[model samples]
Target: MMRGVMNRKVPKEILDLFEKYMDNKVRHLNRKDAIHMLRAEFGLDEEQASTMFDTFDKDKNGQMSIWEFQQFYVCMGTQPSNPHSSAQEVVQKFKDIDADGSGKIDVNEAKEGLKTLKTATGRDLDPKEIEFFIETTADDDGQIDLGAFTNLLYRLKLYNAPPPPKDVKLKNPKKD
Candidate 1:
């Protein structure tokens, strides 16, 4: 037997979605998929979808896992879903907004990050919502450090749910 960490079981719904996504040959979800998924499922526009995706995919990996998807969805005022799109674009946008190349977004940088999202969407998200999202997703040290951000993005991109949402969430609130 291969002595490797047992691959975490993926929820069936997520596995189905992954199969569908793979049938489309999308090794990783891209900007278009992200936008389409959001619009079809959440009624968000291209800009809003893009901004949300960029926010979640902090590592720019062009994919997202369930955990990362949940955080991003919550941040965007939406319920998390099975097979949510990738967070790669979000990470790249974060880096671009950092400007100083410091790999961490301070309060001011965080505000600027929101501005970038607003510009992308042509409207400002609620300030409280923005703060809530940042505070919840930021590192324990209260910084949007690069590694933490990237890990979040990677989680979202690589997520593979093997069962239904109800069962999955009920069985494991904090999936490892």
Candidate 2:
């Protein structure tokens, strides 16, 4: 088994590998670059690399900045191993939801995606709650970007976050 990379400082070689695949223009790694690095350097299969991308996509933007990558490395070092659309599947679903190919899931597409996915919450999600969930994931213009939607799907399948209580009102929930 591969050791938890974060158990100690991330090795220099791994750090070098990150740079080896990183996009110099943006100084970050997109989904493809990250997956390539994970596979080439760590011998992760496609599913594993995709899952790690979800874990590492702190902002849910489908991209990993240097700080996000390092922070993920540090956190990974500290966590216990636990037991996904597999990871690429979640990503593909996100792409499918991006019907217009704008690389983002607009409100209309999000509604459609809600249909494709089974309700993660044990109880059937009410339309209002579904509306709220999409609302929360949306940007100011009311669109769910690929990162936001992918992370949501990942969380739904993996973490199973509970829907908020009906009586509760979030005055200002944090985004990203």
Candidate 3:
């Protein structure tokens, strides 16, 4: 059985791996870059990728230097492990829901996504449920990005269910 370590120090091997992706151009891993790396190298899903990025982007500069990346690994090393999804699938889902290309999902877009969910599953999720999801996922800015949304879907187990092969036709629900 593998033992989990709780020390807040990144192992040298991981740091070496991070160095391979570092370059003079950015000299750091931005959120986009982190997403790509986490997907390709770590096989983390959209939510996991985003969580990893946010945890390590210490300065919130939207980017992480190699040093910062190291810190992230250290943090991960100290945390309890949880299951995650394949990065590709999660990333695709996030892209599908982003709708506005703003890198975050606003309330309106989240509502539309809920509609899509209803059409696909034939399950009418309660308005209160949707509001709770929005409230839990949204950041301080009153919007949730792909990462937070991914986490929400993950917790709901919606991320694991097989998605429809094609888009689900949506009917505008008549609001009384």
Candidate 4:
């Protein structure tokens, strides 16, 4: 949710990529061109690439500028410049948390899911906050469908945070 920090620094590599593929002198990448670049350069499938383009298009105007890309990396967290994931991966995460094969997550299930997320991400979310998230996303009957859950995760960047760097304590250790 951190947006519009004027002094934030964007990595040169990111800027280079944008500069390389810029379609116009204005240096802005429209949605179609960005999608093509993402698919070609990053090997992302169309859906995955489109998702990333949508994320960076902050103004929701089908165009992405260098500044928007910088803000996206900021929102995605430092160190891991790009945390985009395929829709399949996101669907898997939703299925993992849904439990009981119900295709929907109830309030109680959301609590358990929140605990699992905390364990996985080391993020501490209060039970009430988790409940509120579920309540707000759920239907009048109080059950969140898979689509809603996926959208929530996408917006929150829950499934997009890269794993912590692993410290290789013993370089070239014997293979098992």
> How many residue pairs clash in all the candidates, one count each?
18, 2, 0, 0
3 versus 4: better lDDT goes to = 4
lDDT of each prediction vs. the true structure? Answer: 0.50, 0.61, 0.59, 0.60
Deviation in Å, model 3, residue 137 alpha carbon: 0.9
| Per-model TM-score versus the true fold | 0.35, 0.50, 0.47, 0.51
Off by over 4 Å in 4: 1-9, 41-43, 77-112, 119-124, 132-176
lDDT of 3: 0.59
Model 2 alpha-carbon drift over 4 Å, by segment: 1-5, 8-85, 121-124, 158-176
Evaluate candidate 3 by giving its C-alpha RMSD to the native, one decimal: 11.2
TM-score of 3: 0.47
Error of 3 at 123 (Å): 3.9
lDDT of 3 by residue, 91-155 (tens): 55666777878777888888777655542345655555566566766777778765565456554
RMSD for all candidates, in order, please.
14.0, 8.1, 11.2, 13.3
Better candidate number, 1 or 4, judged by TM-score:
4
Q: Model 4, 1-176: lDDT tens per residue?
A: 12223225546666666666785555578888888876765555776567667756778889888788665444433243443444345546666877887867777777787666542355655555465456656777778665466445644555334333344222212223
For residue 167, model 1's alpha carbon misses the true position, in angstroms, by 44
- Model 2, range 6-99, lDDT digits (tens) per residue? 3255555445545667654454788898878656654457765676677677789988766666654443332222102233445577778888
State residue 18's C-alpha deviation in candidate 2, in Å: 7.2
